[model samples]
Target: MSIIVQNISKSYNKAKAVEAITFEVKEGELFGLIGPDGAGKTTIFRILTTLLLANEGSAIVAGFDVIKDYKAIRDSVGYMPGKFSLYQDLSVEENLTFFATIFGTTIEENYDLIKDIYIQIEPFKTRRAGVLSGGMKQKLALCCALIHKPKVLFLDEPTTGVDPVSRKEFWEMLKRLQQKGITILVSTPYMDEAALCDRIALLQKGSILKIDSPENIIKNYDKVIYDVRTQNMHQLILDLKNYPSQYSVYAFGEYIHYIDKSAGFNPKDLAAYLEKNKHSEIEINISRPTIEDVFMDL
Candidate 1:
């Protein structure tokens, strides 16, 4: 394993941020920590990267203990924090040079590793970091993180606020980096991006709800799901939640996804109930499970 975490836990002022979480990343694998804000993903990443000490358990990166061999672990890992923390006053090239210097290396020495990504933003090398666009800033951050040729790259919500096109481009860059045998551990709230990972751990409230490949997770969803749409969306959600025979009901995009409490509940019966309640233009259809559905189920 390039990255191994065993029963790691962390807390803040009596509030548990990470609750004995455990997982591993194989060599060259693009493993993802998928969850929403406050799901403990960032805390776990910090523990593994040696930025913060775990209140309990152990984490190893590149065969170095995160606590005992903090320096070695730090030397081997590249961490891009959730927030953009690069020196805003420095130029793109200067930022890269600064990180390289910290790692006792030069940009020219590791240029080959980040050349593909760096070239995209190379024209703006002289531009101040704070003046760059969100997407460009992301690229420059990535380039600095890679300049030292670290064995593992830890990206915390690397695509949070970028444009959709830039987000797509970033993931493409990740794929290319993975091809070069760099193990990537990234966290993101986007369920769609979960499918892009080799394997994902779905987290919620400082606990992991599920861990598996996206295909397997979807395949294992045993609930009967229905996508319901009606003109009265707000009322429909409330009504569905209050419906005696409903097991689970929540809004998903343009529809309210729901599951029945019993196997024999019929869709026509639901429509009839809605009609009697004066809900017009109701449409409910059986639908396939998505990552968001799995999260909602948890």
Candidate 2:
């Protein structure tokens, strides 16, 4: 295992931040911690990177104990915090050099590791990091984290505020990095991005709901799903919740995805019933389960 977290737990002033979380990341795997804000993804990343010690259990990264080999772990792991933390006043190249120097290395020494990513923003090397655009800042932060050529990279919501194109570009860069034998552990709240990972852990309220590859996770969905679209979407949602024979219902994009309590429930009958209730332009269709749907079901 490139990363192993065994029953790790962390608390703050008697409140549990992470409760006995356990997961493993294989070498060269792009593992994702998928969850919404305040789901303890940051806490787990901190503990794994040795920034904070766990109150219970243990964690090992790249064969080094997080606590006992704190320095070693620090040297072997590259961490990009959720917030951009590079020096604002420093130029792009200056910030990269500073981080390299702190790690007892030089930008030239490990230039190849981040060369591809850095070159994209090289024209802006002289620009102050503070004045750079959000996408540029994100790339600079990633390049700095990778300057030392760490074995494992922990990216905490690296695409949070980036543009969609930049987000897609970033994932492509990560795919190339993984090809070079770097284990990547990334966390994001975006369900769409979850499908890009080799495996994902769905977290909610500081607890893991499920862990598996995206395909397997969706394939394992045991409920029948239906997409119901009507002219009165808002009112349709309200009506569906109160409708008989509903297992669960929630608004999904332009349609409301619902699950019936029993397999025998007839879709036509349900539509007819809604039409009788004065619902117009009602269209209902069965759809494949998505990661978002699975999250809701969980």
Candidate 3:
């Protein structure tokens, strides 16, 4: 494994941030920590990258212990923090050069590693990092991180605040990097992006709800979810939640995704109930389970 975390725990003051958290990432694999904001994803990344000490637990990254070999781990992994942290006053080329020089390398040494991503922003290489657009800054940050060609890469919410097109492009770049044998551990709040990972660990409230290939996690979900909508969505949700047999009720895109506690759940029964409640244009249909649905259920 390229990364191994066992029973890791951390806290701020007396409040627990993460408790007994554990997971691993294989060499040359693209692994993801999928969760929403405040789910402790950043804390885990900090621990593995040796930036923060865990209150309890052990972690090894790139064949070195996080504590005893902190320096080694720092050199062996490339980390792009959740927030942009590159030298803002410096031009793009300057930022990249600074990172490479600090790592005892140069752009020419690892041009091939970051060529795909760098070229997109090479046209803006003369612009100051602080003035670049969000997507451009993202590309610049990634280029700086890869300038040293580290064996492992850690990206924390790399796509957050990025445009849809740029987000898609970024993931494509990651897929290419994984093909080059770079183990990547990325965290994201977007459930749609989680499907792009080779494997994902679904996390919530500082605990892992499930860990597996995205397909397997969805395939093994035992509940049947229904996509339901009515003319009055707000009232429909309240009514559904109050229903005795309802297991879960939450908004999902154009409809409310509802699951029942009983196996004998019938959509007709629900429609009838809604009709009696004065709801019009009721629509309820069996919906395919998605990563988001599974996360919400867990």
Best model per lDDT:
3
Per-model TM values vs. the true structure: 0.98, 0.98, 0.99
Q: lDDT of model 1 at residue 52? A: 92
TM-score, predicted candidate 3 vs. hidden true structure: 0.99
Global lDDT of model 2: 0.94
The segments of candidate 2 whose C-alpha lies over 4 angstroms from its true place after superposition are: none
Candidate 1's error at 6, in angstroms?
0.9
What's the residue-level lDDT of 244 in candidate 1?
A: 88
Question: Model 3 — which ten-residue stretch has the worst lDDT?
Answer: 15-24
List the candidates ranked by TM-score, beginning with the highest: 3, 2, 1
lDDT of each: 0.93, 0.94, 0.95
**Quick one: how many clashes does candidate 3 have?**
0
